[model samples]
Target: MDTTETLQGILEFIDEHITDNISPEVLAAQAGYSTWHFCRLFQWGTGYSVMAYVRNRRLAFAAYELSSGKRILDISMDYGFGTHSGFSKAFRRYFGCSPGTYRLHAHSNRPFPPSLPGAYKYLIGGIIMEPKFVTLPAIKLAGFAIKTTSVAGENSKAIPAFWNDYMSNGMMEKLHAEKFIKKHDEYGVCFQEDMTTGEFEYVIGVERKDDAEISGEYHVCEVPPATYAVFSSPPSDGANFAAAIQGTWNYIFNEWFPKSGYEYAPNCNDFELYDDRSMPDEGKICDIYIPVVRMQK
Candidate 1:
């Protein structure tokens, strides 16, 4: 099903049940998506979380009722607030005035009701190839590791440089000599996020046999078996390499996932595969793997 179509269905549902208590879980189930995936998609598509969107829509209607001389407590309860006080606090925060004041003198300042745009548009252009779904068996990787914040753009600066450092300092040749090196191909592995703090470890390494001996700064990390959504980059010639790669990621998260009806499999690691077939400076060809599972309907 098209994501915009699914979203439109949800919007119709919301409009029909505006006065009813609505939660993320409720909407997600209605849309046949996992709660986490649904929340992210809702925010991306409409610029608000399910709860925030509902609150804003309700507040707009409540303000309209206030102008109609409806009782404050009735208006509050009608919008799913447990008490008048709770509604009033939220109202004041959102509108910068108490409901009473708004009703009496600030009718002109009522917030416009929230609406969803027909579709989210992307300004960047690229070929967004349909992903090949594959299951990766459990494996271990060993190589240089670095700590990075989950914050946007932090890893952007660090990762490319990490790759360069690894290549220039002879780390590649050193690892290739190990008996346990499973293959000549290299892996860029991202650890599962530590939710409590927005931090994760990024490792650039190669698959190694279980009994592989390791020495010095190199470390090992394990990956569990899982299905993946794999995206391929256009020939990453230096000129368009970064843009092409980043645009592919944008398409996956912004365009593909919402429509794919899949959620990231919890506790699975995501990784990039680069082998002799790739030319980081010239063709820069590589495959990106995202762990995923079908969302329970």
Candidate 2:
């Protein structure tokens, strides 16, 4: 088998024996490579060290089990975390919250299995578009804002409803009429997350002109300068536009990040830039800008 197939098999093996004691040496032996060589190959393939990947998978399963109403200690031990304290510490470091808190706002944020080249495609209609990297100046925006959470995928449901209301309630027309508006294009921006509650603020607004006067009713946000990997949704008509956009997002998080050598930049806003191309009769595409920083070695 080639390297891709070998790593895919190893990934499946890791998942199967997640709750058991799994060592790099054991996995190296399984892959028919020396431990030193296997370590390098595994990191190159998965962007995670051998044991780190195992630990993360274990924590993901542990997070899933938290909702089952099982005792925390039992769940920890089942994931091979020997002690509750050890589990809680590792859990906090990886997820930014303790087990109890994550359970209270439980949603599966598990890392999806990586898609090796030629194994599977995550885009809509099998269309693939590579992202372009760009560094942008600070941006200012003014519009409607809503508080949402990732818990139970609340943002997915809440954001669409929020948009529907904005469009139907005359808010969209009112915002565009403002003198402060820099462009007719709209932005759907997700601000940095709150680690404690898994909640964040999302804004649906247009770009604000630099010298424009502020309005009392509008929510304002300023995004600092950053480098971003920008991905465009596959071109689709009005009927399939939303699906196409969602598919690109899935591909970015599930298929790209693990192999991209970059992670989401902290304290920066990621947004969808919807311009004329996003109109029903136009290009029917939206650009997703994700701020990024090189992953630490």
Candidate 3:
């Protein structure tokens, strides 16, 4: 099958088996790729991770069916969820109310933006993709660090608290990691993981090649050379970063991944292009990069 065929087929299969226990790796394999590979391409083309999309679809369908008179138990079972409460929780996430309440207010505007009637109508986070196909070699680095759970946004207390220390200590004013800076005070370094993916205790740090006399608690990572889809994000007063990231994922998974024959690298950090640099007054600028491996379609 063609790359497009495989991609669309997988989506179709997902829709048909919304209630099945098929694993993500199995789904990716059916698409003719590995688990991580499928995840990347799926996100690249669909603008959401494979699993994220599945969750969205499941809730959307469940909402539809329950409103159309399907029993909650049947609806829950149809989505492969183990119990009605589980289904209800997921449904509330999408509809901003219990399925029962959702059915009552089906025609009303959703209290939650992310769970609105047409919430899934648009893909999440695809702005500023301005992607460029570029290749570069990975290098080594050093910097400050703190360990915290993987969070969808910096809403986690640890990271926000980190900023408290970051500002109080004047770490931002005097960043010792200069080599990573590209242009416009734009540091080549960026965030590399998704917290919502159940990752815990990720380190927030920067890279310094030279002996910058690293202080505080931090570690170093060796970035390998690879091809990437880099997207520029607007500067922020620390808000909307999550939106931009989410939008980028939606665009990649919805529009790019299905069309591209590339797969995602397993067990590696995704990329973030820093555009806002140091000036929040610059109007929120940053870019995101997705790591990829070309597949033989």
Candidate 4:
């Protein structure tokens, strides 16, 4: 799925703040954008207005709780509704059931009356995302993107090795400084080119500056200037990277992006940033980065 880490982070703020009294201003603060910026982005990114996402998320949790056997009053209060009557009334309207009746009758697999967004759960890979707002200028890269099955399967490590071998043919020193900016991070983009099934592009390389020479050895791509939400990743290891990436994707897919107002990027790049500074002497140190553009409604 086309998932934006920024939108994912925004949804995460919603998840973290769901239990509290969250105004759009508070929610925006959590999202690292001003209320105006956040609201616009939220609306643009997600089809819902800010309040809608909060209510829908609260409702998703409410349904989960009910399915798990939590009391209606409890779900309501946890979601910030203080009165049973009010909660039940809203519940019946949104979910078409009285709380008591829902617990007694609704199947374990289903909860709520109906007419709400899907569910979201916490995950491990995206557990450490701390997103920041940034504005980056246009940059260019030289690489090839082939659709891959899944990173866990095979190509994840192999493609980078391919890039390295390609680079090692002595292309980096020959590539121009003005046209390209080399980044240690790798980019892994996932999006739905079709409904249900998703698409992925994994690219690794340095940015090509304007005057850069394009020898037959390289391919070129461009990333334009736009509002970006950046997140920091935990230090990498053979042990940690897989788990962390999985968690991040799970969080982005299962939790954050859907509610953030942004739809999947038509064609987005999921990033894996590396910090040579953080690399342990034993192996390597790196982080993941996914840049996203707002999905049009």
lDDT of 4 by residue, 200-290 (tens): 3455556545675676656566665545555554445666655555455456544455456543332334455545533464344444444
Give the lDDT of residue 51 in candidate 2: 73
Candidate with the greatest TM-score versus the true structure: 2
Model 2, 1-297: lDDT tens digits are 656788888998888888888988899889776554455456546656677778888999899889889999999999999999999999999899999999998767554565677554445777656799999999888999999865445777899999999999999999998889887889999775544344679999888999889878999988889999999998888877888888887677656765677776766778999988897764599999988887656
lDDT of 4: 0.54
Candidates ranked, most accurate by TM-score first: 2, 1, 3, 4
lDDT of each model, Cα atoms only? 0.75, 0.81, 0.58, 0.54
Cα lDDT tens digits, model 3, 153-258, are: 3335565586568658867556644444323232233333341252333333454544445545445665567777775554444566556555555556555665
Model 2 spans > 4 angstroms off: 1-121
> Which ten residues in a row are the worst by lDDT in model 4?
190-199
Maximum-lDDT candidate: 2
Candidates 3 and 4 compared by TM-score, better number: 3
Give per-model TM-scores.
Answer: 0.61, 0.62, 0.55, 0.43
Q: Ten-residue segment with the worst summed lDDT in candidate 2?
A: 35-44
Judge candidate 2 at residue 52 and give its lDDT. 70
Q: Taking the candidates one at a time, how many backbone clashes does each contain? A: 1, 0, 43, 26
State the TM-score for model 3. 0.55
**Full candidate order by lDDT, most accurate first:** 2, 1, 3, 4
